[model samples]
Target: MITKEDRERVAGWFAGRLPKQWQSAPAEITIDREEITVRLTIPDVDLPKDASDAARAEARVGRAKAFREETRKQRMEIAREAEHRYDAKVSWGLALGDHTELWTHIAAPVMTRLRQPQRMVLDTLVDAGVARSRADALAWCVRLVGQHEDDWLVELREAMASVADVRAKGPATR
Candidate 1:
């Protein structure tokens, strides 16, 4: 189980290890059981006041691609070290202006057992073309729930973390 301290330590490590020139601000680090994603907000592209939306978007994409190619070696080395230390794969991304791009992130498969009613729900989504398969339908459903209940989920997570802290302070089990 990952604790809040573990997450903070990983973020702090990346902040100190990353080159100062790579990002204008501290990297945004997100960690789960299988992967750690580090996103950096780089300096924005400067354009004329009358620049069109297409020009701005093109510039952002160009900048992101160039940055990815230029920093490939350094990023790989950092990822290798991080992966070893954290026992998880490392994915990287960059944010420029309003555009963000993530690459090489894990899509770990999940396993679950559902009754007929639950299975029907997934089947309905697939039949309606909302998802390509049961797996996709399940993923869509989870994303929908997350979007709708984000605040409640956050509160629940906080409560769970408090429980973990309390458990840690209790007597050791045999």
Candidate 2:
């Protein structure tokens, strides 16, 4: 376990090298086996709050690229120090804003009642080495379908929206 003092010292080392605008941003230090990872997140200010979700995502991509270029030298210095001090592999990645909209976090758990045959198919996928377990196989299958049928998925979502709109209009009175 990393001591509080050590974590603080590591955080301070990187914090001083960060941009003045990001001086107060939080630092997360994690140690695993023989490597230490230090992550510093900065808010992406390029996109307005009112920007569309796609626009925000695109802006985040641009901001990450720009930040890496801007901080390359300082980050390399911190990396060298971390390696020399701890004798461990050190690397870092940046996150934009609160990171709520990252692709992995965007997925919500879906609970569905499946027929016995469907359940068996998921189990078979695990047995065949297609996935680690039934849940993992189900996730893999969903991802496969999503990747191969994005246009169909979009149409399905539009249809669902239309159904909801019609339902919200209420039934015709006799």
Candidate 3:
């Protein structure tokens, strides 16, 4: 686990070279598998209070592009140093534009085939206002079960591994 000191060190190194707008933005760092991913939230542009929506949108895109181009080298250097120090691949992302669009979690769309009963259950959830859509209702249901059955899930995984091991062994000799 990377310590707070390591996080601070990396953040400090970038604060100087990053665009002024990003200097005060929060830096979020996480490690997955063999990679250390760093994301720096971009601050909102300092636009006039009377600025039009179109102007605000344009400013955001322009700022994000400029900031990315300006800091590309610095970001690479930071990633290199972080990879060396942590002995893991390092990646970086800029939290640009609108907050929701910028920080959305990256997930691949999944295609699933459900039985009639399962489909009806999800539909029922939506109709009852349990969730906004079938996808959301399914996600909520997953979260509910995951929260309640964490221990059961863990034990099930362990048992499956044990079974796999037992099956790998050839029939025992008497």
Candidate 4:
């Protein structure tokens, strides 16, 4: 992907960017036209062996490799959990349509699993003019057919916080 002249030109450019303290640093660059990428690498070098006594110094590259694998595993697990929770929330909300369906499907399950305040919050969203209807509240607050989880969650949190502030201003009337 590179000619000898291209390599020399890039290396010259890189050498100028190095610090004064790094006078001995190696300058290397590779350009791949097909990928539209330029990779620059600085070669690692060890100090000269002293008269005291030494064989050769080797890198613990495997340790760095293992550390990368561990970070990857943690990231994958977190992503999987988020996706599963979002899927279940969307499926549950879809089963709820009207009163008859809600009573049979949504009410018992929510009452069993969710805390009182959480259930009340969902109910309040439906009662307010913020949402078009019960299904709209579900679609807006959580994941369902029409909405994205991240954006809808942001809007829902803002609306809920505003509702709390309004309630604090008003009387204790239910």
Q: All candidates' lDDT scores?
A: 0.94, 0.68, 0.69, 0.39
The local distance difference test score of model 2 is: 0.68
Report residue 118 deviation for candidate 3 (angstroms): 13
TM-score of each: 0.93, 0.51, 0.46, 0.20
Q: Each prediction's Cα RMSD?
A: 1.4, 17.2, 10.8, 26.1
Instruction: At residue 5, give the lDDT of candidate 1.
Output: 77
Tens-digit per-residue lDDT, 1-174, candidate 4: 244454455446445543333232352332333211112122223335462222222222332233335444543453244335322111110010111111111221221355777667667887787676555665566554335466776576567656766766788985
Clashing pairs in 4: none
TM-score ranking, best first: 1, 2, 3, 4
lDDT of 1 at 75: 98
**Looking at candidate 2, what is the lDDT of residue 23?**
32
User: By how many angstroms RMSD does model 3 differ from the true structure?
Assistant: 10.8
lDDT score for residue 31 of model 2: 54
TM-score of 4: 0.20
What is the Å distance of residue 14 in model 4 from its true position? 0.3
Candidate with the greatest lDDT versus the true structure: 1
Worst 10 residues of 1 by lDDT: 157-166
TM-score of predicted structure 3 = 0.46
Candidate 4 positional error at 130, Å:
60
Per-residue lDDT of candidate 2, residues 20-48 (tens digit)? 66433666665544666666677765656
